[model samples]
Target: MVRKPDFKILYVDDEPKSLRYFKKTFSSDFIIVTADSGAEALDILSDAGNNIGILIADQRMPEMTGVEVIQKARSFAPEIVSLLITAYMDLDVALDAINGGHIFQFICKPWSTDSLKIMLLEAAQEYERNRHCLILEQKNRELEESRRTQERFIYTLSHEVRTPVGLSLNYSDALLESTLSEEQREYATSINVVNQSLLSVLDNTLDYSMWESGKLVLHEFPFKLSDLLERIEQAFGLQFKTANVNFVLKRSTEGIDNLVGDPDCLFQVLVNLLSNAIKYSAAGKEIELSIEILKSSDRSVDLRFAVTDTGEGIAKAIMDRLFKPFSQLQTAREGSGLGLLISKELVTMMGGEIGVNSEQGKGSEFWFEVEFWLGSDSSDGEEPLNGSRTVEGIPILLAEDSAVGQAMVDGLLSPGIQRGDR
Candidate 1:
């Protein structure tokens, strides 16, 4: 069934007989309102509010010419499709009207009924097309502005949150270094966990804004998959103590070595999946980070990484919002909610895809697929990074603008390493 259009046609002429003939001819196929004079037509257009889609006016009206009426009608209905009717041959006037864009077309004294119908319908379609195009352009502008506003809010909020979060982490680190009772140590551990989560959220917001603005930076380096998993395991190994969750890295048995990719970005995406799993799981529950080799070639290998947890599964109602920022499920534990969003973005940047599968009563498995170029571990003449590298008495200059960044560098550096001003 065809949906009827909601707009109406407006015909203006000084002759009452012409008005009655136009209504009798086209009233069955179109909704129309008639005006006997240009002044009356302007009043109808001004009061019609958007109901008028087309206007057919007589050129030989005593008060005003058709071109004059159409030109002035624009003040009320700028996009109205217009056609002029004339009883005499006036090619110069017709050319001026068409060239000036005051009228869509001119009809001779005796117009064929069939030809006039076709022209009127075509003008209606043209009006519809132009209206839709203008609406689309306006919507696009609004969407762009909304995205800019969101980015600005994220940036402002991230900076405002940075100072307090950094102070909290610095304090927690100091407290952890000192000897403490079991309860005090547990309290410090909890604080550190929250601090790490905040840092992760801040990092994600910044990364997302950067990605949206086309300023995200990525690095490619050579490293073994096993080594990267081991590092993540070690980092999470300490954090898992707070919840007493069993965190395991189920590495693939394939001979995956010397992979070249953005390790930091991949690491962050994996950490997001794993941390989310940890958030939803209970104490004593096990969470597995597994990898599988999908396809391998001479220079590149495709792989799938998954983090599965035996926690209460997700509800279907919130699944659509799973990867949107600040849409964390209402669970026993709190989360930043930006992890999965940024994870999806990072995975895409790494030429990968990410998703999750779950049943309400069972558990959830969040997964991502990525491809990496195969290369030697060493680049240039420098030795490959390893666990035992030493930098005794080596002076390194630091130039970081973030307080948490400077503190992280400070903590990661060895005791023998010296830091100097650049």
Candidate 2:
């Protein structure tokens, strides 16, 4: 069924007889409003412009021409579809007006009722299309503004958080080096671990923001696959051991050892997977890491790495959105909910595919397959600390704009301050 159009059709002419005839012809099909002159039509439009969709005006009026009235009416209601009616045989003026987009259609002095009705129908459809397009443009602008606002908020929050977290970590390290009892040392270590976790959350949140804004870039370098796996094992070994979860790593084939890729990104993906496994698995359960040689050639090698956890498996319904940003399946645990999302994006950026297999009762297996070219020169795979260094007994200058950040830094470094060092 066709819905009735709510907008009215406006007809303007210098002759009262033509106005009457137009209203009498189209009154049943549309809400017809008649004006006898261009000036009067402008007045009607100025009063009720939004309700008028189509404007049909006669040319050669005493006060103004149809094109003049249409050009002016467009300023008030830009979505109105305009039509020109003229009896004079001069085509130059009509052509100019049509080219200027002041008119949608031109009708001769003696226009057939059926053809005029069809033209009005087309004009109504055009008006609707223009309205819809305008709405979409407005919505897109709003969405872009919202995204920018969110990015700004995330950046500000991350900066505000990092200052204190960094100071805490530095102070905790100093405390660990100082003399203390076994219980005191344990307490300080716990504090340092918790602060490191907080710092990790902040870093992950910033990385997620970068990915959302399309600013994350991958840096490639030559590295040993075995070295990368060894680093992953070293990083998570203590955590898994403390949790009593068995951590296993199956080495890659001998031929596919050295490869060219982003070792930092590869290690991050593995760490995220292992961390999740450790977090979800129960004590005494097993968490296994294995690498399989999917395909190997002279230049490139494809390796599939899987992290299997003998923990409570995920439901089928939640599996689809498992990798979405801020989507956490186990809400009981504390997390930033961006680890899986960042891992997925990092894997894809490195020309890889990641997936998960799980059942309600059975455990979950998360795996990724990535291909890397075998590097020509052998690399020791010893990663340099990316611009990180420590210096002792050197007077350091700290510049922090926020007063709270300045106080936190001062408190953290007070123990190292000598007499008259203020």
Candidate 3:
């Protein structure tokens, strides 16, 4: 049998003859190191503790007892397996070694070679087991500390960054309500879009953290599926109109109007899909959203929602990691990279499966299938009027640092401009 590498056996005795005999007998089976006294054994340990796996000390030495040496050796390499060799069977010494927590076995002076070899093999195995356990324990502690640090950083970012973003959104909304020229309207719209995008990034970051911490919860209630689609159309209709892209929503042959589920989460997932479609597709490209009812019963209905886009299709390699957090494909446009990850998590929490199918040049289709409870009544299909068209006559104050933003604000609030020198 091959001996274990780096497993050194240290034999300590005041008598040189005993030490020499022990080394000569066991030198072939193990790396035997001889020490004349407790001091010499400790000196070897201090220099080669990492390589020394088993330490056997003779009792009744000149100055230090075996128990004392073993106890002191533990300070240098606490994981070393220790043994006590004695001619006299002193019960007190045996008890002391047993209770010290370091000694693994006690061998008499007249030990058979076979018995001593077996005990040493067992002691080496024990040392390895203890060392592995300590390594694993330390790894667990580091992981826990890292998680806590990430939690604190996310918390601080959410609180500190969102305040100004919220203020910018409100200011943009105020500007949109006021009367302005066509060019001025475009500028205000652009500003509103930028602020909204920033707010979206913030929201995605917060959602990712919540999901990672197992703190995200779903709230279910009665809602109309048709009404949800209508809201999505209104939200993206204006965006597509400005971008000159074709946006279509198709209902399946069999449609379910009323359902009981979390509307907010459903809306978020759809919005993320639509936003990506818009961001990646070139002008004049077509984007379509569809809903198909797969199965229906008295209590529940299974629906599959799909978004197909005629953009640059995802590569096979990129698609593999599409839903991973903070992972993004190389593109000219910028994104938070958390949208798809959050969308996948939300779909899973609602007991649904989300996936994507794409080809190199043929574009892509993303879909999710979820089951929801049937509602009591059907939807009326009444659409709400646009709020920006109705709300007017509110005096707005715009404080913007950027020149373009200031010009947009000034154009919106013309004829009431006041100048002050700085």
Candidate 4:
């Protein structure tokens, strides 16, 4: 490959006629800078260190040798490639210089112009390669530091804001449950909705930061597929109804019911797909989720989850950018543009693959397939509730610094405690 004259070559010799001859020989092919002595060569290197890509100097100079000149130039311009011009008798010293890393190669006294041009080109290419690696390494270090900073910010923000959001949501729930007029109940419900949205944003941010820092982890536990579907239907069924969309959850549950996996991550992935479907869909549109059993055995099972929506379908132009971080199909929506990317990451971490099928004017289907270990069968034909083991008789001690946080925790745990489930 050939590059334009972006780099310069510096040649040094004590003979003025030789310097002139060298420049005229390759003046059209390369950018050549000549120096008559070692001192002049060092001065040029000092001023144009970055632009000079290759350095070639005569071994026998007036004050200092070419090896000394190249070694000194390397102190400030280590990325430059160096070659020695020597006679037959100076071959031994040139060999020492090459072995000691003072020069890259040596040329004989009566060098062929074609051979010398080829050597110079190779030297320039070597300099380019080294410079490219240095730049790439620097960029990687910067990216690593940025990821660390983002992780720290996510931690600090969550620690400070979680209590307040939790308090607001639980208090709103409490207020709605108490006796109140219709308007008051509606206002409390609105507060609950807003707080839930804020909490979702916070969760997504924290997940993205953890993923960037390679700290995102998935926990495995046993859960019933029916319960998982029930929770999702209970959570988003009303949202679909309110939007006047026909929503259905089709569960193919004949294969396996009890499985071990990360429920939270699977839930979030479904939620992201459903949320996007809700945004582009209009009234009277159709949205459906299908959970199909693909393969099953006594030890493990593989299943496919798909979300289909009849909305203004994705355009062909922007389809490839769907899963990229910070890329959105539509700029008018409200989001960090990380939902699809986060889903992809979570699905991959769980040993699954995600994809989409869409047309310009038709609807779209987003699907993923994952494998889960089968849980041990229960003799009583009963599974643990949402992956939580039995802790009915255990004494529990809760701790929190904020009163609001304590109240929220107490409110959340009271129902389970009353039912003697935890």
Tens digit of lDDT per residue, candidate 3, span 289-329?
98888888989999999999998888888888888876768
- Worst 10-residue lDDT window for candidate 2 reads 382-391
**How close to the true structure is residue 26 of candidate 4, measured as C-alpha lDDT?**
83
lDDT leaderboard ranking:
2, 4, 1, 3
Candidate 2: segments with Cα more than 4 A from true spot: 1-54, 60-77, 87-136, 159-167, 170-180, 224-238, 253-258, 292-294, 315-321, 324-336, 358-362, 376-422
Candidate 2 contains a number of clashing pairs equal to 0
Clashing pairs in 1: none
Tens digits of per-residue lDDT, candidate 1, 3-43, equal 44678888999999989999999887888899999988888
Q: Please, what is the whole-model Cα lDDT of each candidate in the order they appear?
A: 0.82, 0.83, 0.81, 0.82
Instruction: Give candidate 4 regions above 4 Å deviation.
Output: 1-88, 99-101, 104-163, 241-246, 284-286, 316-320, 332-334, 359-362, 378-394, 412-422
Cα deviation at 380, candidate 1, in Å, is 10
The window of 10 residues in a row where model 1 has the poorest summed lDDT is: 413-422
What TM-score does candidate 4 reach?
0.66
